[model samples]
Target: MATGKKAKNVGKGMKGKVKETTGKAVGNESMEMKGKAEQAAADAKQAGQKAKDTMKH
Candidate 1:
């Protein structure tokens, strides 16, 4: 049972992956770069949340 925020972040990361793959398939460098950045940001956010949760335990 994941929290809503965590689920959202995971969803965002998944969407970013799709965008990156689609961009690459279409040969759109800018879109691919943007997607990669978005994915990184989402992953960082998720990691931060996990750290926060661990500290509370």
Candidate 2:
């Protein structure tokens, strides 16, 4: 069973990827930039979750 935070972070990253791809297909620069930011945010969150989980063990 994965931690909720980890799962959510993974979902967010996946969603961001979809958004980025869709934006590229449609030539929407703003959407693409937003998706990139979302992905970066999700990555940061996942890193934080990993650090927290490590401290618990």
Candidate 3:
């Protein structure tokens, strides 16, 4: 079973990818950057959560 934060991170990352694709299709640089940032943040958060889980074992 995945932890809550891990799941959330994954969901957020997926959402960001969708946004990024949409933005690119619409020629919106700002939205694309925002989506990229969101994906990065989600990745960072997921990595942090993984580290914490590892330390717990």
Residues 1-57, model 3: lDDT tens digits: 257777899999999998899999999998899899999999998888888878889
- Name the candidate, 1 or 3, with the larger TM-score value: 1
Residue 48, model 3: Cα distance from true site in angstroms: 0.1
Tens-digit lDDT string for candidate 1 (1-57): 249988899888888898899899999998898889889998999999988888888
Whole-model Cα lDDT of every candidate shown, in order:
0.88, 0.88, 0.89
Q: Model 3 — TM-score against the truth?
A: 0.90
Query: After superposition, which runs of candidate 2 have C-alpha atoms over 4 Å from their true positions?
Result: none
* Tens-digit lDDT string for candidate 2 (6-57): 8899999988988998999999999898889899999999988888878888
Better of 2 and 3 by lDDT: 3
Distance (Å) between predicted and true CA of 53, model 2?
1.5
Per-residue lDDT value at 44 in model 3: 93
Instruction: Please identify model 1 stretches exceeding 4 Å from their true place.
Output: none
Which residue pairs of candidate 1 clash?
A: none
User: Candidate 1 — what's its lDDT?
Assistant: 0.88
